[model samples]
Target: MKERNILDILGNAEEDTMEFLTEKCPEITDAELDALIDATEKKYKTKKKAKDGTEKDNNINMTENEVSGVEHSRRPAWLAPLLTAASIVLTAGVVLGSVMLLNRHGHNGGGIEQPAVTATTTSVTAAVSTIATSAGTATGTAAMSTATTQTVTAAETTAETTVYTTVPFVAPAAEKLYVDNELGSIALELFKKDDEVRYYPMGGGIECDIHDGIKFAADPELDIWCIDYSVEGDSYPAVHDIAYYCHVTDSKFSSLEEIKNYARRTMSENRYEQFFGGKMAKDIDNLEYMDTIDKEHTKFWIEYRGKLYELAYVGGWGKLPSVFSDFYPVIIADKTDTSYTAYIPLWYIQVEDINNCICVELKLILDPEFNDWRVDNVEQFDGKHYEELYNMLKG
Candidate 1:
């Protein structure tokens, strides 16, 4: 009989036979069988003496040695491949069994039932699903982050673009007053109640109602006076309707002499000289000074070059310069209170030639809180005491 290769025998074996062979000799392989055959041939060529003084073939001992050598050398090399082949066989068997079972129960040749997936395929599918889910979560988180950033940016932009408007101011109705003997005794008595101010003569005179529009400060040591007043009506940009009333008053001295003496004490020599010798002196020359027993307040006005000009003086403080057109006669009225100075520039057309020249009238408003003023929708008058003057000037 022709010799058959062991690999061929295994390949052609029936399933039952192969299983039986595998169970009986699990470690046997074609290389191991070849080693056994080689050992047998060597054993036959070399005889050994047996215990009975007879020569014997050591084929069985040689076969045992060959089997041990093969196990030591090849066992380590074959283990991974054997495991991999066994796994492939097991997976294939499982798939084949499932397909066979499905085919048996499936509709006759019209439809085939899908085979159950193997463990490896199922594991791979599960891994892919997990990766897909993770990607989706990452995408959602990125989108949410972008949306939040946009919302915050939009809110910041709105804040930047929003404009703030100013608020209007209301006057105080009453304030406190201080009296000093050095400034000379005045018969007027002042007091405040609920937001209203009332004054009357200590020695019986006309009663007067006033607002907290006036403020007064005097230094007997320096013989200086600082008075602040607030005015009603519209003002120019950064300008307030207030006036700074400052001067010195002495009952024993004449008004002009007292003003000259104060100027000498407070002003530079040049300034004092310039004031008396300049246009101010000429303007003073044209003014008419009048006093009344009912109100000790002095009033000054002048009709100059067909225009009427006025001096504004209140309380015991001296006069402030005028800024309205000379053509418009202005009467000094109740002055308001403030802490800082404000300026309003008044433009007037010359009466001589209405189109020839434009004059600027710079008026000062003194308010303590000048810096705190905010521009709002409030109307400002040219001067609080100038309604009659305005009418006359207009005429």
Candidate 2:
């Protein structure tokens, strides 16, 4: 779904919005989760303390009023503070629930949310055309059962089983794919998702072995999944690109309006510097180049002025350098979150990193083999936060 429409669905404010973030980002570990929770708790405590002060003032008012000859009576002043605390608690729970859903459904943190989805028993129709075994010794009667109760294992159980029997119910079947190319063909997939082999068929007589590999590292909840698709090679035109995104709850998508509001409010208040109180780009123009990446699985960053602005995108582990350090705002002032390599029609760019500028690289959503417009920087792995995640998720 187009992210623009997701704004209504993505609710990012309303406290504990990171729940949606957790849903969208798969690589977050237990430590990260702890960090997030701790951070949130601290924030809540701070808010509660300030709000409690308001209650104290009201308590003083009621006490003074009761002592005076004002004929009116009122409830305890502490009541409002108690109620506000309760309200905050209730709101936090609801927001947490929404965020969990977003993570499970793989919602995009770029303020897009979808409904939480679980792998229910989808009635996958197996178009079985009885393959007539040519050998005479293969006389067998088979029963094809479409059983819903049949336990399905994701990686544990696969469609590539091999235990033949009179009732050959096992599988080694291929997945079905139906591409709806109306939006726009993804520029990256050097090897189409359905390509028989990990190679590309170019127009000329030349064929390229492009391992459009995408590997995922997901949280145990399986709420969201992210894939890496950086490429490897020595020179520019010989490199690769990457991207991916998983599922997320619809409610999560609806929740991001809060963050947008917060950003706008920060801008309006002119107190964003006081609020965030740290080094983040204060002006939108700082990263205006973000709009350039209009395709899936691509990112556009802004940095560097006179020289080259290194915009980058990648696929596969070998191409990690081009996408990570090479595109970092510090190294080149061009960067993207590595989790974004697999999101098709890539959109989302970090204008500044650590609040600084460097080089800029043009990130191509599906460009393989960087020509004049492309360059390759293939490295096995750089121990990026995302890389650590993919490692933990490997089957």
Instruction: Residues 1-395, candidate 2: write the lDDT tens digits.
Output: 11111122244343343443342322221222332344346546766776667556545444734553334344466656765765664454345444433453443333111212121111111111111112111111111111112223554335422111111121111221112232113213321221111110100111111232222222223222121112232212211112221111122122223322333321222222222222111122222321322232121111122211111111100000012222321111122322012212111121223212111111222122212111111111112322222223332
- Per-model clash counts, in order, read 18, 75
State residue 349's C-alpha deviation in candidate 2, in Å.
Answer: 25
Q: Which parts of model 2 have CA positions greater than 4 angstroms off?
A: 1-3, 11-26, 46-395
Instruction: Give the range where candidate 1 is weakest over 10 consecutive residues by summed lDDT.
Output: 140-149
Q: Cα-based RMSD of the predictions, in order?
A: 52.1, 26.2
TM-score, one value per model: 0.12, 0.21
Alpha-carbon shift of residue 17 in model 1 (angstroms): 99
Model 2 Cα shift for residue 379 (angstroms): 20
List candidate 1 segments past 4 Å from native.
1-253, 274-310, 313-395
lDDT of 2 at 348: 11
- Give the candidate number with the greatest lDDT: 2
